[model samples]
Target: MERKKLTLLQTVFTAGVFSAVSFWYGFMFGRESARKELGGLIEDLRRGTAGSEPTPRSS
Candidate 1:
């Protein structure tokens, strides 16, 4: 019984530590503005617009 309780406690502690480290790693590497800019660049490339601004097209 005591061994089982110890094993459960160890598992809980390990999980908590792992979660904290994962969260910190993601926060440190994830830059919101940079990600947004990269996404926009990708979209522009897909649309065949690399640099210039899009002008309005009148019918």
Candidate 2:
């Protein structure tokens, strides 16, 4: 019984650690992607090219 409990605890801990690491990696990747996109948008705005394309209106 003790061994089973220890195994279960270890498994849960490992899963939790993996989940946290995956979440952190995903969050960092998303943030970097957003930063890059925003940087491009800012540059386009600064160059006055942002308004050259017509934006689609959502009904």
Shift of residue 50 alpha carbon in model 2, Å: 1.0
TM-score per candidate: 0.54, 0.87
Candidate that would win on TM-score: 2
Steric clash count of candidate 2: 0
Model 2 residue runs over 4 Å out of place are: 54-59
Residue clash pairs of candidate 2? none
- Model 1, 6-38: lDDT tens per residue? 999999999999999999888867776567667
Looking at model 1, the pairs that clash are none
Model 1 alpha-carbon drift over 4 Å, by segment: 32-59
Model 2, poorest ten-residue lDDT window?
50-59
Query: In candidate 1, what residue range of length 10 has the lowest lDDT sum?
Result: 50-59
lDDT of each: 0.80, 0.84
Residues 1-59, candidate 2, lDDT per residue (tens digit)? 99999999999999999999999999999998888777777877888888688444322
